[model samples]
Target chain A: MSAKMSAATYPLSGPAKVEINEVAPRDGLQIEPFIVPTEGKVAFVNALARCGFARIEATSFTSARAIPALADAEAVMHQVERVAGVGLTVLVPNLRGLERALSCRPDEVNLVMSSSETHNRANLRMTREQSQAQLLAMIAEAGKAGVPVNVSLSTVFGCPFEGDVSEAEVMRLAKAFADAGAAGITLCDTTGMAYPNQVAALCETFQRALPKTGLTIHLHNTRGMGLANAIAAWQTGVTRFDAAAGGLGGCPYAPGASGNVSTEELVHMFASMGVDTGVELGALLDVVAGVSDLVQRDVSSQLLRAGPRLRTHQPPAWMEEFFAKA
Target chain B: MSAKMSAATYPLSGPAKVEINEVAPRDGLQIEPFIVPTEGKVAFVNALARCGFARIEATSFTSARAIPALADAEAVMHQVERVAGVGLTVLVPNLRGLERALSCRPDEVNLVMSSSETHNRANLRMTREQSQAQLLAMIAEAGKAGVPVNVSLSTVFGCPFEGDVSEAEVMRLAKAFADAGAAGITLCDTTGMAYPNQVAALCETFQRALPKTGLTIHLHNTRGMGLANAIAAWQTGVTRFDAAAGGLGGCPYAPGASGNVSTEELVHMFASMGVDTGVELGALLDVVAGVSDLVQRDVSSQLLRAGPRLRTHQPPAWMEEFFAKA
Candidate 1:
């Protein structure tokens, strides 16, 4: 017998505190075709706020003409009742969008830019430097307004158009965000191009480079590795993550890219492993159901289909009879 | 500014060798309502054999009446042309099934029972003790017949009828299987009830008690933790795994339990991490397509749906023109 396996619980060893940021309202709904009405979006965010998520990306304040799905972001954000612990973060494109989002008085405003120049051009309709310059200004302006800033560096792992991205480039952008009065940074696997190894290596770099700044990972499950990569990231000491209600969200630009990692699934995995996410699984399930109703389509969540692991079934009649006789 | 992030590439770390045992022929088809033809089953097994799978569970020698889906197990076993590198194993329920499987001269015969008594009765229609005694006899008989025996302990993590199986109970069954001269013992998450922590714990116990014996994991993606759990198991130093092509298995007894971990997806994950599974992803994808044809339905494969992560899309017209203009 090998001595390495002497202990029973070694491999499942992971960090204790994992804060999940619900991004259903921002990344999740931004791409949905059927516009989730303002009231319904507000209700959903309010419901999620109660489900023990410490952070929620409420909605993106992009141009209404661009992402029509989240056109009512101001109304949705202003309408939702803020919970004491939940930090409502709204996505903004530039200075103009920041002004509109600040009016809603979200707890934080998140800025976006792509690590890939081509991706930045396609997603934000500007070059990477142009978006960065504008975002640096937004950060400075938001800082003046006393609103915390978060930067989501998209396509850090790989881009849909340009293929593999360099780690140095991602760090460069992350360093820029950290230096520009940004409170937090999110490394976005924009189209599920992240592998576990890449996630770990990147996270190690992030932790070493900017240990004091808050870090979050936003992953998509297009290639079915959202949770797996998230686990890898968590192992490297990343405590915050971006998850969608019922695995909502897909890239409107990147073809075949699917939903973000399911919030309930992440909560389920962490809870199962004895890690604390402070989520109420039963209440989270209700929010998932509500999201499903709001979308009127099947959500890409495995937990939604198969309930919690301990959910038992009554033994078959034959087995019951045989056991009863026994 | 850490040296780790200074490198352009990092993160894809894994064990050099990962053994993948394809189980679609047995576990994948056992629950199908429509019976795959005997010839198709043979060809599918033969096809999987060529796809760099070192092991394949060819069929189950259970009573034809008990599982009509695999009633042609004998015919399928006889027709598959034995390949040099592939070890074609067969599943057996009891001494009678072992006898039937031995007649076909399989490379290995896997004995079956459940960790939970009720699951054993429901699955094998016998008490755990009775099944263990019968399996011990089968092991002795198969040993004398110069055939190897592999025992699969089903529902070692959690049982549908009896939830939260104790680690001690699982270790007891694994120890029994090891003592009975079984060549390998597979820990079966028959109903997708096994979480990563439980997998890690049981695997540690198994390695401690039977370190030299062959160990394999049979995981289902029922709750979507299949891949996440697989990563956990890998971290614990267990490499051999049982995966179904196209994720083609389901538990008949455990209703709503979904398919096994998709073999191609596993291959993809390992390969992306620079680990060697010896299986060609493109060839495996074709095999997945063929299995989908045989089953006549869409199987739960993320790779089949989204393609590989590096599979680049032709940048959309707008993005291409934008970049061209830039």
Candidate 2:
């Protein structure tokens, strides 16, 4: 074994902290088969607010026909009780969505566009240039409303339609958004195609390029690399992450695949590593259980089934008897 | 962004390679509800052998009544085609198991013990000291038969019955085995209690202490940190890993949890990171499909469902029409 392989270079040392943005309400519920009632959505957001999350993306102000599951975006946004430290964010698709979201007085509005032209066109029915220009216009409008903007660049890692999205393309979009007065930028692995190396390399570049802007990683567990990618990014000092409770949100295009990295699992991993995410894991898990109930199915969360890492189990009856005899 | 977050410290740079040990036929099948026939086991092992694994743990030599799922261990081991590049390994529980496995002419024999006293007794029906003495004697026996011995220290990270196993305890056992001329030592996270920081710390120490002994990490996906821990260990230059096909095999103790990390998922993660595992992921995925069928259930493999990262999808019908209009 080489001495160079030692833990001297372990990125996290003492009392490190990361910000978790809960996106289950908007990202998770948007694609669900069952529509949670507006009250239920409001209740869920309130529950998450108490869990110490830095932000909770309450709902998306998209056209009702586009995502009927979260059609009650305004109701959820207006009804949710505000917490002092937790910022409430809502997705804004275009100028209309931004105007509606601004009327609700969201703390921050998230705008999204795809890095790959094909995915951009497929998802937004507009080309990359058109989406960027529209989002730039939305950023200016949201600025007038005194709300910060976070532009989520979908397929910054890879596109389902176009395959590998280049680093240059991702940098261009991220820089464009940062230049347009966006307070933060989220790199979305829309199809869970981002691996650890890709995540680390991109995060390093993004962080260096936009040191003043907050960087968030939005990953899916579609390929089982969500936590791996998140940890890799965290190792590179990228502190903000987007996770859905009970792993609820997934790409509509990737059939049969899991959703965003589970908030409980990501929190569990960071907490186990002694990195503070400010969220109480027990509280987060309780919310995850409610998520399972609200969604009417077992969600894709590992911590939901296998408790926390420190959870102990009793030995077999035979072993107990043998030990007693001994 | 700090300069410390740069890719200058990234672990893998060139054609880095790691060894993968397929343990599905043994560890994976042992915990399954369905029992595959002897020929099916042989065929599965043969298929895995062709996938370029460094080693294939084919079966365990224990009483048929103990784990009836793998009762045909002898038959499967004897019938598996001996691929030149792939070493066939079998689990040997005691002196009798060593003798039985020797008769089948296994390329290697893996002994078992638990670092925790409670897990040791619960798993092997003996004390840790007694198990170590017995394994040492068996190692001498295997040495005479010219078969190398690798001791798998279960719950090295944590024991379900005995919450946390100490690093000193793990180091003591690993050093004992290395000093006794064991070919390798596998640190088994019997339950997925391992976080990446713990994995990195332990792997670094184990690698430094036993430089000559091959270090293999056997991780479970119980808490969804399987790939994260694997990558963390890989970053520390501990190359050998043990994975099961279709992610079969769970701790009969940790109910409602996943089993070992899926072989295809691990291979895919490494392949995606540009790290060479020498296993053809497509071939491994095909075998995973077989394992899924043989188990008569959908196994806990993400790659099995999501396909590879680069698998492109055609845009929706409307998007295609929109593109055509453009």
Return the top candidate by lDDT.
Answer: 2
| TM, every model | 0.95, 0.95
Candidates, DockQ: 0.58, 0.60
Tell me the tens digit of each residue's lDDT in model 2 across B27-132.
9888888888888888899999999999999999988889888778788877889999899999989898888899999999999999999888877889999999
| Residue B253 displacement in candidate 1 (angstroms) | 0.7
lDDT of 1: 0.84
Per-residue lDDT of candidate 1, residues B230-272 (tens digit)? 8767766677899988888888888668889889888888777
B183: Cα error in model 2, Å: 1.0
Best by DockQ: 2
Model 2, docking class: medium
- List per-prediction Cα lDDT, in the order shown: 0.84, 0.86
Regions more than 4 Å wrong, model 2: A1-15, A254-257, B1-15, B254-257
Clashes of each: 1, 0
